[model samples]
Target: MKKPIKKQKAVLIILLSNIFIAFLGIGLIIPVMPSFMNIMHLSGSTMGYLVAVFAVAQLLMSPFAGRWVDRYGRKKIIIFGLFLFGVSELIFGVGTNVSVLYISRILGGISAAFIMPGVTAYIADITSVQERAKAMGYISAAISTGFIIGPGIGGFIAEYGVRLPFFFAAAIAFLACFSSIFILKEPLTKEQLAEISAKTKQTNFISDFKRSLNPHYFIAFIIVFVLAFGLSAYETVFSLFSDHKFGFTPKDLAAIITISSIFGVVVQVFMFGKMVDILGEKKMIQLCLIIGAILSVASTVVSNFLGVLLVTCLIFLAFDLLRPALTTFLSKAGGKEQGFVAGMNSAYTSLGNIVGPAMGGILFDVNIHYPYLFAAVILLIGLGITVMWKEKQLAESFAE
Candidate 1:
């Protein structure tokens, strides 16, 4: 048991670092992607499609990846996924055409689908119900740290060339891949391994797939879908808004993302654990949704650069508060089938990703502020769903 615990901690560290590196790769490209597209003379709709393609690919692949993680081991899948991510980044760095960019994003999405669910399941394997929220919060903090650094570094390098950010991202992903190979260990016991194998053998893939689509899991999936849709709207449009409306440079936009990420890290590290303990997952999620909705709406009205920056930070804080609670709730709802649940969550998030940028791009065409208004409405709807979920007691019972 002691050995298991030690291995669990080691796996958590590896997973955290893996998530950080992946986020770094994604974040590094985000601030510069539109500009890069502009340099290539791509249309706004085309850019939106490019972003949507990533989500679409992830959505298509996540269910299978999740099943594989449950049947196979998490460590092998994660390492392989990271290597693929590294290769995708390398391809993006070398390729100049829009077709190449789309292919690269598809590769990245597939890698992400595999990596994220596998890592989350690995965490679920090692952690108790009570410790799960805190663990997830730490993982979220790692992601926040990556977001804080990636944009800054990418923006600095992007001044040289658009491909530089991709190259840097490739380097980071390679580092993460190497780290996973050397430092990560499998966390499953022999019994658990046998059980997973037996289930895979006894149940057909279709049945196993259908079993993963539980209603409780679907409820969590809907919440993630709405949350991600709203967040992605903000993410896709924010830099463009800053540039068009406030005349902010790439560096300035990167700074805003960096500052927002700092706030996110602080909330995830210090406040999320305590919030989960005090308010419980359901109430915490409701509170976060309310706050996030209000702040997201407010972001539209804040015209000045400094004011927008401040509001953006608040929005990130609300997200930080929301994410850990939601993740814990989702994992709990998954119970023994953690990988399938994580995959469903990933698929829903990908669905949101598909919808968010497309909607934001449409609104961006209409008006710069329209996406935030729409996001506010969606988030309000999410709040209502959270209040009406009727599973508060269920969540409390599952808490560690």
Candidate 2:
């Protein structure tokens, strides 16, 4: 019992650190990218592309990332992902032109596609169904915390220059990567890795995706997509929105993001396990989407900073609820295809990121209100799907 507890603690530390670093990299950039666009004299549409480009790379690479996790082992892919993440931030920190920024984002996207799936699969490999949701909640809390603090740090550092935050993000990523190489242990031995890798290589994303389309959790994947899509609209244009509407400073943007993440982190870490136990994943998801949609749409109408912050807090709380619940749902439903399913989960999320910002960007340009309105509509569609989907049947199939 002591041995197992010690082992769980060690693995939890490693997994949580990886997620923190990855999201820290992402969060550090958020408050600064709008300024970057201004520095380059880029349009909202262009900025949207820059933001979505990372997910586009993720969308393209996630399938391969999933297979790589199954093939090469989670440790190798995670380390490589971390290294690439550092490289991407470093490139962005030195970026002078739009082209350089785009290249950097592509690298960042590829890195995310690898890291997200690898870390998720590694967690799934170690934990049991009973404990998986609790584990994911902690991981989600780490991600939210990273994203929260990163922009606060980045915003303060941006007093020097916007690009400096990317450098800072890179430094943290490299440190995390070093830790991974030195201390992280692979749960699977060489023989298990070789066998699993061999078996996974036979199938591609198309087949694997089709295979994942059983009655149980296909809607869950769609929910992930819709949730991300709705959120990225706000994410892609947040700094711009605040700047245009209320003349927000970088610090202000950081404050908003930090506050939001704090709300998310508290729920994900402390309340998530019991909440899911009481509400179940499906009910939790449905309620969150409904309220979140209402909040997303409401955000468009707020003229004051306090109102905006209030709505953002609620919206973020909803997102925090969804992230871990969805992760736990997929993990429980996944069974043996830990790597494959985790990869697909990231793929679906990447797909949302792809569409959300791209569409959000274009819409934000048209009218400040359009993006939020569209997000509300997208989530409403998701809510309907959640309402109509055969939960009892899916649950039964998943158990089988």
Candidate 3:
């Protein structure tokens, strides 16, 4: 049964709030990391490992997490994930050792793996097909808003103590967790979920992945990977690239990134859905790929601060738009398999996140510009793949 409009809006607000808080917690730790490294006597390589491990854990868990979401229930998984997120942040705040921090990150990864698919699947269940794209856009915007605000708040709170931000993050996560237990509703019934689970019964993760390679989903999955890969490559090296190439200060880099994120959020909230409705996902994806490729290459050549800022913002904006466009497409096509498909989408994205930064870092070591150039090349390849893509079977369904 669908929720009443007023009740549905309230539920969506709570769901988006949880998502915002979760990502905000992630952002809250960014500014304090340097102090963390110094206090803990951690090396750069150790920091890299910490970041990589989170993605690794998320990648491994997501397929199973998806299955669990379908078999269990979205509200249950979301509540569990929020509790885990709270615990992870609290552990990270208090822990003194690298091993403890790694444990905390792993839990955080698992929490993310659970929460993302659950929330996405839940949203898919509540909204009619016409509402899905706009709803997905809000999801992306909440995330970007968290990231945009997180560092600033983290930096300010770090005035008291470096660990304070983590504690604050933990507090909010716990608050959200408790609030959700009281407020959130399960959107699907047992029989509905049982049906979904039956439709998606694969023996293992490998089989799940193999099923994703079916013609209906294969192209979209590839686009998800390329989007993650190209965007990760550009972003992971952005600060270093700007600093190295243009002698930009930390404040300068922060301003550029913050401004870009704000712009991306604006577009997501106001324009993304309209664009999707007007142009369709296929066209929007193709256009964003072209934008990503051109702007990525543009970033390498632009020397002035404004020129670089504009190019960088445009590049990120392309990425921000591209992500939801893909998700909206997947949601439309996924039908009863929403949870499973959302899980695989998260998995492919994690796979790209794992590889992209590592490769970008390696290429950055070779030449500062290599990462952007590599991103452009990868995006062009994605664009090529999308050019021949045609959506026939799903087009009629999507039209409704």
- State the weakest 10-residue window (summed lDDT) of model 2: 1-10
RMSD of 1: 3.0
State each model's CA lDDT, in order.
0.81, 0.83, 0.90
Cα deviation at 63, candidate 1, in Å, is 0.7
Candidate 1 ranges beyond 4 A from true positions: 1-9, 31-43, 158-162, 200-213, 243-252, 391-400
Q: Could you say which candidate leads in lDDT?
A: 3
Model 2, 346-383: lDDT tens digits are 88988887778778879888998888889889989999
User: Candidate 3, after superposition: displacement of residue 327 in Å?
Assistant: 0.4
Worst 10 residues of 3 by lDDT: 391-400
lDDT of 3 at 137: 93
TM-score of each: 0.89, 0.88, 0.97
Per-residue lDDT of 1-400 in model 1, one digit per residue for the tens?
2333344666677789899899888889876877887788899778767777888999888878877787778888898899999999998888778889889889999999999988898888788776778888987898788877887778789999988899888887888889888887777766776687566544344654466455566556778899889999877888877888889987787678778888889878877878899998888888888888888788877888789889999888887777778888888877666777787778878888888877887899899989888888998999887776776546553652
For residues 1-400, write the lDDT of model 3, one tens digit per residue.
5654345888999899999999999999999999999999999999999999889988888988888889888999999989999999999999999999999999999999988998889888888777788889999999999999999999999999999999999999999999999998788889988887787666378988988898677788899999999889989999999888889999999999999999999999999989999998899999999999999988888889999889988988999999999999898888777888889999999999999999999999999999999999999999998875676655843553
Cα lDDT of candidate 3 equals: 0.90
Off by over 4 Å in 2: 1-7, 34-46, 95-98, 159-163, 198-203, 237-253, 300-303, 365-367, 397-400
In model 3, state the lDDT of residue 49: 93
